[model samples]
Target: MKLAAAAGGTLLVSPNFAFAGEVDNLSIAWTTDTASWDPNQRLSPDPQTILKMVFDQPIDMTSDLKLTPGLLTEWTLADDAMSMHVTLRDDVTFSDGSKLTTEDFRYTFFERVNQGEELDIAVGFGTVSDIEILSPTEAVMQFSKPSPIVAQWLSFSASYVVSKAYAEKVGPEKMKTSPMGTGPYVLTEYQRDSRIVLTRRDDYWGDLPSAKQITIEIIPDPTARLAALESGTVDIATELSIRDVKRLEQGGTLNAVTNPIARIIYVTIRADGVFADRNVRLAAHHAVDKDLLSKAFFGGDAVTINQPTIPGMPSFLPDFHFDYDVAKAQELLAASGFGPDNPVTLDFATTNGQFPGDYDIARAVVTMWEKVGIKANLTVITESQWYELNASGKLPPASLFVWENGTGDPELFAGNMFDADLPFATYRTDEVTAMIKPLLKEPDYDTRIKGYEEFNQYLIEEGAMIPLLQAIQTIGYRNGIEIKPWANGLIRPEAITIS
Candidate 1:
């Protein structure tokens, strides 16, 4: 096996490997299962990881998180930032041997807009008004307003293109179970909450994947995933805890790889109901010791974050600080007429084993909040349930959630989280809505950064949400299996090589 330099100068397995022919099988133990087969119907992290294998996006991101071409060969944004022209690859074909053209791209982006239907992945296409098909391989995307981040959106989640004829024939309901796309792999078998099997297409348009067949077993527990990797039940195990990764590396047969991705683990505080008061929200924010949580759960592998944006991002605030003070938290709780004698009680939702150390970190934060006279009833829920509740705007007072920002764009991070119109916004207020609307459409780079900096300062003052820590992607695999770590944390089949 060859070793190459990865992000942060970490040594990882190189994609180049001497092989005679196609490898037979590659089994992986995944932390979560995909909620939907349709790529555009779901906006969560787990589904995107699986859907990317079958569907090709307009633009792709390199392992280092740089933009590259996927389905579209070339894309150029207009000078006014109101439109974008994209040229698709004419050689690509779906698994059923049908040519992939601009018609599929048009339907993938503008079909919902034409029917006046609500889009599940609204953030990517909120400003896209129309897609004018120039030819079989070219189209122009027209936006309702200036959209500077339109190119970046092409590489984000829910941006994958599907076969237009197949989708229209099957309709939306049947498309969820049976989906077709122009990609390297085809979804051969799917068992909800259990397993998924994908087979490589022999006539794929791009480079063939190393494995001829891929089996992904949905194992939600971190310990179970580690066990599977150790017992040789699977070749690769993803989303393992840092402690498990350290243990695996200490042993000889298994090796561990880790990369800090563009996702943030934070607690969302509802703007209404029990947390309607800003002082109560501030108390919750002050109670969490982000640095301590990082050390205890992640073994300092993850970096603590003060805001939604992380380091190296455009909207990252270096000087912004939200101190952890038990006294301050208690004082704020008292101001809200709650103390040790009459504790402030509320329900807190979190998922177990969805990500590395998610459950442990939530428990630690709950314990910290208890010290400040806040009685939080922590409830463990599934990822699907969390999404359902979030969409209905019925989440509890506080919920632990992970926001995936693959593009590292500020508009997708802070902009979507605080935008009053988006369902992801937990702290929706007239002031916050007014503050975020202008930053979304600002085409000037420096001006947009300045506006986000001011908006972040306002969010800190108002205690909009509790930003905990940046997430790290950890995967453990056997000696013979080679995998390159992506900065976005997705385990692509094409990036895996078997010896």
Candidate 2:
């Protein structure tokens, strides 16, 4: 799967500092900082990883994405499957030494559902009707219908519990900087866009971490992060491009590991503006060669997608895919009444290094569009700026976006991006909105598959989005440092050791 060439090759490897099996303090260079300290506010890998340190959800998922207990000791579902009962671990306590109770679970779930309009993870709880406390250590969560997947949704990081009393005393605004949870790490300092420092709690309920102090420095540029790793300043770096991985691994002072995640890096076109014409959008889709892009930018490590779903996912329809055809694209452009003299121009927005080789891929796509008589103007912005534009509905007609569904559920992708009420949705229409109801309400497994099939068919035929490729999570670490990488590209601080 190695595809990218060695980058500039200018970074010099320094001598190793820590001896084998001597991990005490560790520093990691992450591509982005937490958008919010409150666990339920934002949904992304960096923020989720940070929240996992300070907060613990009632349930957690294994690497294979199976549901497991975190704060809860046992769970039971009614025979009808409409209600779920879980018992909390009375021994679990927050960093402040307050015992965790069922009331904390009620407060977090209710708050998330009430603020569903602005949160991405809210889609997971669509069937949840109400949560009732049975006792101090037990509670019941009722759903509108039988939802077999609700337990897995509860394991998501967005469901991480916070102390109701602590949140009430501090208020929502203060919680953004200071959060209270029952995880193994205590956040001591958080500097916006700079660094976040956490210390291991002496009384953590689980096995103690090998490192006592953890520092996460935000370095947006991929090259700068690699340089820091080579200079012995940083022990681990995440989101490295395939090229950087090749260079670092070849240098022999560092090790690189790549894991394909449940994320799709694709392009979204706003149907209301420059892409109002269906012919132009379809033409642009056919103009770019996804296979070539996967090889050139990703070094063949990425999976080229035709529809929203990735290859290994259950809902992926291999029969329906868009192939590269220059002649077909030119014919579609001609039918649109736009030619070389009257080229259809579009503003393309993307980030520099948000993903692996993002800038290069964007430029390459623009060049491919130019060949089909479409002129695309490129705008490279920061990750935060891109999110802001999308949230405000000010994004350009065509923009690059990534949807990472760590749960590996088909509904997470279809519901979040197409559901009209959700904050992350981009394109909205009567046809797409109408298709969302059956997908969510259908309780039968076979029937749900049919709903997704029909929904994907509509999206492909209507060209709702131009599918690109699934990103591979690549981690670069200093030699002698052992770190476990999560399936969602999260580098957990508790899993690191010097050896």
Candidate 3:
């Protein structure tokens, strides 16, 4: 039962355990609980995982990163590329027995986040001008300019369709606790931060999942999650400790899987305070020994990155590289007119256990920077406070965070984090904004890719953000539990099946 890394690092059966047909319910313990069930409200990984089960997207991105029909049977792009015609699947109906219509798509895309709703998906949608319903089953997504990645945006979990009727009937606050959608599972109970229980929707429009019930038990401690999975109390555990992964592989009783995810573990530098100077930022970037950090903190589960965009994406330049050179970092710091006498002192903010060993990673980064004459004070904050500071543009000097390009396209990454005046953006310059503008309106795919390549390289050279590594996603599962891994690092419980 030794799992091969080439085979997605998963094992189906364990020699120590026997396959049981009575395993009709799948229980998963995760480190982070979902923030909200309302699709548009939060962009965290766990909530998006549950949203995918209870709601259907207008389109779906396959494991191989191809766009496929989900609720929409077919979709076509206009010649100008400013608009797209989407044909909905008339056979699909919401969990509330409401027929899925173009109106639902329109409301979900255009109006759901309007009236001052603080939705992150609004940024994902970019500059969508309007969603005009041509018929009950067809609609047109009109953009002010050519939107090259509109389809990709619609395929995002935040763009998952909700019954406009159900939402208006229940109101926003109530909808967060109780949601109705067209996917294979329905939220039966939600005890925030404790557990979420979902029951299989027998009358779902899509193929029913083999597991009749899915329980997402929130176990914040990684050790506790590993214990639960090893004791057979839980079928799966995510965010597993590196030590646990090695033990599972050696024992050959449980399956440990690693999916190279699209998430980039990078530091977002605020364009204020001591980090306002590009030279100081570049000095800090050079101070990071990405190789050492990945090995020490990530346990060989991560790949070091040099740019804001991650590898395996559309416009990633595979050959572009950055190496750690303490001498070069010191030179850059001295060149920036800062040395031991007037050292660059900054506070680094990060969330504890938000990502795998994030707190320790922050400490490691600070130690590395101190060698280059930059003094960094570490401030561990709660997840909510970290996000609040980032949103309000009050992130101390550098904030340790992971930005996931779930659409498999780098455009979303650029638009949300690099675009000028956007919420999460820290290094928003006219030049960077100009580079990202073409991704929205560029007609040729090659040209769009070229734009992103240039944009990412420019950011890397300018040290717009400190690129760390691709956050490797690990899954621990009991024997006979077969579940496909998602590249975006979300756990799709509906796709789980027992053999």
Candidate 4:
């Protein structure tokens, strides 16, 4: 098994996570709306506030999910880091009072993540080849493919364990309407736009969060969020603008905790998307000013990426990352037959739940392109709508889209986008296909790195998605919450403490 940690290149660590300590009853407000309670669909920030409420991620790859144990008790890897065997504590039970079984594990993958467009993150789950349920408390997962990061990727919330009983009654479609899981908190009320309320399960099987009720309010404006924090109207507000960082730090009522995310902020180029030709893709790549967007809109909170995968992933990221040059952009633009008269304009749209301040990012990117004689329209859509358009090719007739790199395993990234037949996003290349196929099933180490390097370089040469700045997902808290930053990009609510 070839385990190359950060085979891509070296990444600089952010000092923000070296926390001072924990705060109590931390309050937070979000700019996005929560339309679905179904854990299988796009999960909102509100659901996340009750860390253990809605769903618990499957702790093991082989068996049905049981909220038995996590991180601490036991996990073993075949010295090569290719295959992992997980052990669960027999003591844990779900909020519904049922014992988790391996069959439930089979149902989640065979039924949900593997089939739908919504939960394709299973591309990471595809690693487990065979499973032998040793009992209700133990299981072994064989990797059809050797991937060192499988353990870290298993930590994604998409793999959340669902109650088979609830899924059967509600059906997967309606279950999405109101989800039920073995989490620590239970969804009490969802007042659209106003608030989402959760109550701590008194009999929670895991470490119980101190707060009895987790209420998340919706505050769209950044200024209002900051004001609420200062006035004590809210406890935790997400996304601190660069301009207000100092004020929050100085104010007695609020404290800011900033950290870099394992996720990369990027513009995905569709392979078979409207602009499939290499020249057209390259034209679009050169047309945008990633640096300006990073500085002006993102306020320099983001680091630029040389390609799709984030820094320190698996391949060598180039140093070509920089500002958008109009002349060069025009040269590529003209060469692609997209001229001033034949001006190219695309609509950039994203769902509210997926990213912070993405709508603003859309507008700012538009301004960057207009300066280069190109037009970019902005639209803010729901996650479902965004994915629908992305899958159907309706959104970017040309538009702006950011694909968070490294959130899933590498094959899912390449297959869902680059595979001509089954891709969920856009873009395709024979070169991409060849590199991905062997890498998907290959268990060799150095060979996998070679495939990744070829693919990374192909992205630059092909100019698929204009690789934008790699940025951290920022989460701000009031004075009392203590939390650890996720090195690979995730916020597990149960792990946070409010004093």
Query: Of the candidates shown, which would achieve the greatest lDDT relative to the real structure?
Result: 1
Model 4 lDDT per residue over 90-160, tens place: 44456678766654554564455545546544556655656567776556666766655555455444556
Task: Single out the weakest 10-residue window by summed lDDT for candidate 1.
Answer: 1-10
Query: Which lDDT values do the candidates have, in the order given?
Result: 0.82, 0.76, 0.77, 0.58
lDDT of prediction 4: 0.58
TM-score of 1: 0.92
Return model 1's CA RMSD, one decimal. Answer: 5.1
lDDT, candidate 4, residue 349? 65
What order do you get sorting by lDDT, best first? 1, 3, 2, 4
TM-score (all chains, Cα) for each model: 0.92, 0.89, 0.92, 0.78
List runs of model 3 lying over 4 Å from the truth.
1-22, 114-116, 340-342
Model 3 lDDT, full chain set: 0.77
Could you give candidate 3's per-residue lDDT for residues 225-341 as a string of tens digits? 899998898999988867678788688799988777878889888767887788898899989998898789767768898987777788889998876888888888899888666
Candidate 1 per-residue C-alpha lDDT over 388-495 given as tens digits, one digit per residue, 9 for 90 to 100: 798888778888999998888888888988887777877788888888988888877788889998887788778888989999899999997777777787888767
lDDT of 2 by residue, 71-171 (tens): 77667766556778877777778999998898888777765566553554566665678889999988988888776556656766577888988977887
Model 2 ranges off by over 4 Å: 1-22, 74-82, 111-128, 144-149
lDDT of 4 at 163: 66
